[model samples]
Target: MGNQLHASAIRWLSHVPFPTTLVWLPETVGADEEALLLAAPFLGESPDGLSLCRDPLGKPYPARRGYPVPWLHISNTHDGGQRLLLAAKHENLVGVGLDVVHLPRLRSPHKDRAYLHRLAARFMEPTEYERFQCAARQDDEEALRRRVAAHFSLMEAASKALGTGLKVGAFMGHSASLPLSALGALQLEPSVQLFFDDHAQTRLATLNAQRWEAYWGSDDTYLVSAVFLFDNEQINKLPLDEQTPFMSY
Candidate 1:
């Protein structure tokens, strides 16, 4: 994993407007080690010199010399088995969100297509769900499962960016009564829109007036998703032309 990024990941990360990094590893890395070890490069600290502290909402940020670095943000998720995903970005007004879904579990006998359809219904708009169901009916079970899982991953990732978990308010809906679909219309950065990679399933949107960049990708084992939120200040702080390529992990 020495600085090499998956081709799909490279294409997906290239569209981000700021220096963001993602790390995927075995869950055995140790819970605390997830951030401390992987975050050292971005935080300018050796793993031994870094620690973690959480905000009131329980979001973790790295601490250096025993002082918390509030401006930098980190997030992590475990696959419920043997994998972990972490994301980090060092901007004063930014946050990162991540989620991992085990695809094989979704196909378990008890968690079949109908079960997934029911889960999707809880979050998707009625019309969106109808369309998904219609398409799923004609598609193979695995395709349907992956598409539904992608939508879930994107929403969960957005919630993490918002620091609200999966609450109703994170829906980004027109109203509390109606929420937008995960694949619904969104205001994306022009560069992101032009270079969109279907393989990575990237998406960008605005939530509570903050800029949210959401992305997802998968292998046979699991689907990983991440989001980066640039608060209003960070959003306006940099001009598009001045933004640089993503940082190395």
Candidate 2:
């Protein structure tokens, strides 16, 4: 497969060629299982591939037949909390990761500082921390919320691309910066890159590096998903248009 990114929700596909495909689901779409069932056929896999299910806590559920490709699953958070799921095929050598969260409308009180700080320390880069600090100093609630959302989302994307789920602890080690360029320089494990766009209603982040690409989208209904090719080097050798085995599918 070749390395590229596509907007699954767009009417016109991008010209960039890559072996990977990104599927974005609206709030109306079902959870991971349902989304996978709909997406499997497009990748030339059977509906049974969606049978395997796992909870956000990483507990494995039943699957009809194990998938032959890597998959990253994401869903939005409700009033309680959110869930992220991942699955992959060892035989075919593919891996996937995913994450999701609801965008915060208001900043929490200082009483919630401990929790937020811990999360920031875990997933934010130094530049991101600076930006957050600056936003906090100005008492800009909206800016703070957006930065936090962007930081977490990017980390989530990186985690998925690395195929570590959240098992790895480096996520909290990074932060967001004022100038977006600072983001490209952060040294993250798995050598991932973070991309984001934040507005009043939504915050989206994606990580693309080498043969892998991971993404996170948060709003009233948020989601994250990632796709990775088995042979990392093979993707670079092929042209973008001719990239994945699924092109014909």
Q: Which candidate is the best by TM-score?
A: 1
lDDT of 2 by residue, 136-226 (tens): 5643444445445545655554444333334334443222212222222132223334432242002112222224444333333332333
Tell me the tens digit of each residue's lDDT in model 1 across 140-200: 7787787787767766665556554543565442221212343321212222111112211
RMSD of each: 7.8, 11.1
Error of 2 at 165 (Å): 2.9
Q: Can you give the lDDT of residue 165 in candidate 1? A: 55
Q: Give Cα-based local distance difference scores for all models.
A: 0.56, 0.38
C-alpha positional error of residue 187 in candidate 1 after TM-score superposition, expressed in Å: 12
